[model samples]
Target chain A: MKLDSAGLEILSGGECLNLLASAPIGRIVFTDRALPAVQPVNFCLLDGNIVIRTAPGSKLAAAARNAVVAFEADDFDATFRTGWSVTAVGHARAVSEPEEIARLSALPLTPWVPGTHDHFIVMAPEQISGRRLSR
Target chain B: MKLDSAGLEILSGGECLNLLASAPIGRIVFTDRALPAVQPVNFCLLDGNIVIRTAPGSKLAAAARNAVVAFEADDFDATFRTGWSVTAVGHARAVSEPEEIARLSALPLTPWVPGTHDHFIVMAPEQISGRRLSR
Candidate 1:
């Protein structure tokens, strides 16, 4: 279906979650020294939380500890100028329990960057919103 | 050149600016009620600043006033697992002068979302960084 260039459809919560689940990567936005920062990372959705692996002592692992952050993912086509974006905002916490970490590691998430990924950060989303632009 | 997965090449300042100038879309990260929030936007590089158009009094326009924000743009190939990302951190200010707004409107920035985008937000970057990953 060809949508109007001005059409921006607001997605429902279920739609947002479904789109998020279909993608394997997203950018995590967090604050560092009172300034906003963003990093692209591969993530997975499990048990209503967005989970990602990070190296120990990394800025992401350090700043995201029990802090509120935003996660965004989008698929855009520059040629067609059509795409959809989803943003989930919530509190991020480090996965401490070894058993839970093992369980999460078993999930289908692989670190895009090469390194020893020893820590898992889970963002239990309190808000999920998305928009799709088509033409 | 096929780069190893472990090789994440750091981009220099000129490289970052060149990448930023090559893309017309990016995500703007800012604080909303002290929580990090991200929104995908269409922007252009002008006179060493990242300029974007937004609707007046929107959350982005409101929170970004004199605020330190982050702007990010990237292109990744999911199949090949290779991409580059550029991020700029700086202060955002509203462009109130009519002449400046008129001049920016003449630039190549076209907002993807349809609306009356009368307000222009200029991000004067203080720091710019980027990374390129390859297989």
Candidate 2:
């Protein structure tokens, strides 16, 4: 679909989801201390949810406790002027089952920051939506 | 400071803050439904905090219940390759006081989404950090 904006193109649903599945990193959006917040997170798609590992006292641990939040992943190539974004709105909670933790740990996501990866936060989507912009 | 990325020049602290102050729209990040989430929010900088209006059943109302979330705002001009980003990390909570709500409503922030603007989420930053990239 063509977007009204100059040099903007809307992507099909299949193409948008494909971009999301292939992208390794995305940004998570939430409220921190009563304001808007975002952070770059390395995540993997597991059982139709986004899984991320964090430190005990990290922001991720604090934001995922029994609340609804939004997660977005996007890929942009300036040279090509092509980009796609996938947003998931869902509830966030900690994954504490020993077996689940072990399984999640096996995923390819590794925290670039130095810390113990004890806190596992998962975003389960109640609604999954996406859009793509291209030139 | 100089960043190695091409066409990406680091912004001074003051300049970055200025851009943040001027931008009227931004995206909020949090965890929801067990994953990372993001939503576009209209906000105003008030007393060293970011404030937004939302519906009671909306995602914003859910993410801010009790979490450490990250909030970020950025402005970019592709033609000039100039942009700046401001990110805040802090706790989120509901504002229940009648006097405070009345005061906050007076701010320029008006919810564009259709709903009762009954939920007021605030993000009080423990740390405010920002960066700007210019050509």
Error of 1 at B65 (Å): 1.4
**Model 1: per-residue lDDT, tens digit, B14-95?**
8889988888679999988877889888888888799989889688899999998999999887778888999999999999
DockQ-based CAPRI category assigned to the predicted complex of candidate 2: incorrect
DockQ of each: 0.63, 0.19
lDDT by residue for model 2 (A1-135), tens: 665222234555555557667876566776666655676566778877888887777665787676777777765553454555677777888988999999998887776444477678988877776655544
TM-score of each: 0.93, 0.55
Residue A109 lDDT (model 2): 76
For model 1, the superposed segments whose C-alpha errors exceed 4 Å read A1-7, B1-7
- Residue A13 in model 2: shift from native, Å? 3.0
**lDDT scores of the candidates, listed in order:** 0.87, 0.68
